[model samples]
Target: MRSALLHVSVPFVLCVTLANTSLFDEVKVDLAYDHYAERRVDYLPSFLAMPCNCLVNLAYIYMGLYWLLNCRGVKETEQGRYMREVFAFMAVLYAPVQWVRLASLRRAPAVLDQWFTLPIFAWVPVWISSIQRRPARWRAPGAAVVQLLSLLSYGLSLAHERGFEVALGCHVAAAVYKGACVQRDLGDGRTRVYLLLAVLSCAGFVVLKLLDHWLSRYWLFQRLTGHFWSKVCDVLQFHFSFCFLTTLTQRAQGKTASQEE
Candidate 1:
């Protein structure tokens, strides 16, 4: 996996560098300041944004590779193999979604950005839950229902207030419910540490988002790294979710093995 990822990174990094070079050149021209004191278009330090973008994309690519490796170990059942493939495919989706979001922001409404991301957040738990086989009786349908309601609530809330509260509220509830079910099935072990970290990561993701939103309202934040910080938190949150879900899935498998013995 490491070797494969390293080979993949070479092309990925080269592409990003070339893309950003063109993008920044265009942004400079389009966002140029007027001599007569007209307002400046919103922009960030290219140095900062470039590196952050690279890191975010790298994290996503790594997760995709991780799942590709995981797929090899999941041959016990057809369902397991399919789930692992789905995980890998979702990981691959992250980078393209980000690219589309960047393209949208260049000429489209900011709301279009959410179109690329919101569904991913909603469906992620459902996918992970299905793989973990928690809530054994209704795992698939239950997970689907939770994600659907979360998305629907988010859509309505976004229409009414144009903020993340209602939808994020539903997401948190779903995460908690899913986490609780996982916890109930686990016997005491170090996997508990992974669960704890997952919870902490979720909390951190929320706090960082709230802070970024609040601080971005002030000009000082633009100069001092509010946006960059938000990017970092976004990368961390996605990586942490992968860690938690994979660890929990392994623990579930362990329990199944012990029971069969």
Candidate 2:
């Protein structure tokens, strides 16, 4: 899995090195230490400049590892397994990309950080598509197409100041809308809980990050900071997404088996 992810990400990372970025105008990227509410420790290395924010990125890896390793609890189709693995791989990959941005505070890593986000969010709908039917051969191609479109949407950042925001908003909206619909149609009480938690986490991930600086005026948000909490929320959302998708996939598989028998 790691090898496959490397094969996919290495070229993408290289491409990001060649890509132009929107540090100031388009996306809200924190370039300097002052951009974050967490105070940088002068004694620490550059990687741990903002200790809380830096250390929090490890949560993504841990969450991804938890999902990636625990594949035994539920049985799923080949396509469903593929979807889960790819999403887990994305979480694992995302950790370092964000860390590198905080460490280097460079253009490429920052750009790569934001660019990678779109496709990750886009996967929600692709996973929903998988739930809508039996596992088919074409699911992979369909997923690839969704991801490709998501990747190309980053081009909007170069074209407009708020383009990335617009793209991200659409992705989030689509994920929420589709998730809500699926939960309404086919979900039980447990899946409903997962979906609600995922949505709340998604909201926290966005709202907290947006309020990073503003929230710092309060005492509670001073140390760990809004950004750090936002990361925590992001990890929670990832975990819940895994929960929701896997549970739904397992149920779908059971229904299929029953019909077959």
Candidate 3:
């Protein structure tokens, strides 16, 4: 009951706050001009125009709640240590990156409108470090292939300006590969439900990309909002994948221990 209330409260507050804001307009504007801008855009207009900040704060709140709810898993010494190291690295990196981005805003090129960075740098490094330090005993060959495909998709995104035909292909391939690995690790049960959700989320992104592509020509904005959305989708997908894999591994380990006992 407490957990259910906690889950409901944060999003409810966020929704209420966002209901009064111009966030939707901002997102529309941001998406409209994301590709054509050249300079460091002010955060105020975007912040005032959109509810992204509110949403992000809400995400942090939920993360805190999740940590509280799953304190046992998070408190494990190995995971705790890795998280600390990752946070430290992010602290070191975010300042310099932000400073550079702010400084670069004074000189805007035609191709470079507003340069923005996702704050996920805070958690991503930690996730990678955790994966490295606590290696999975059962290495899924498909996971390696998925990672490679993801990398290739990223590269294709950098190369292709219009539609993500190549990137989409790579993304789908990687999603399928990763889904296979997740299914293999989790077996057929509750874990499979989580993995399936992740797979669907990944596939859903392709639909978003297609919509963005279809709408690209209608807008006259000078920014690359679609590009930013694509990048955001990529980051979110990666986070979901990591969480899915980690949880599956932990479940597998628990099953092994129970069998031995």
Candidate with top lDDT is: 2
Please say which candidate is ahead in TM-score: 1 or 3.
1
Write down the TM-score of every candidate.
0.61, 0.92, 0.43
Error of 1 at 167 (Å): 1.1
Segments of candidate 1 deviating more than 4 angstroms: 1-55, 74-76, 103-109, 116-118, 124-150, 187-189, 213-224, 257-261
lDDT of 3: 0.39
Error of 3 at 194 (Å): 1.2
Q: Model 3: per-residue lDDT, tens digit, 112-206?
A: 11111222221333243334334444233443343334333333323445323444454455445645654664556765665566566555545
Tens-place lDDT per residue, model 2, 1-261, is 555476457656755655554333455555787888888898999999888899999999999888887895666666777778888988998999899999999767787888889999998998888887676434567777888899888878878867889999999999999898888878999999999999999999999999999999999999989999999999999999999988888887788788889
User: For residues 47-79, what per-residue lDDT tens digits would candidate 1 score against the true structure?
Assistant: 223344334555666776676675574433443
Pairs that clash in candidate 1: none
Misplaced by over 4 Å in model 2 are 1-11, 14-17, 20-29
| All models, RMSD in angstroms | 9.2, 2.5, 12.8
- Candidate 3 stretches greater than 4 Å from native: 1-44, 50-172, 212-243, 258-261
Question: Of the pair 2 and 3, which is ahead by lDDT?
Answer: 2
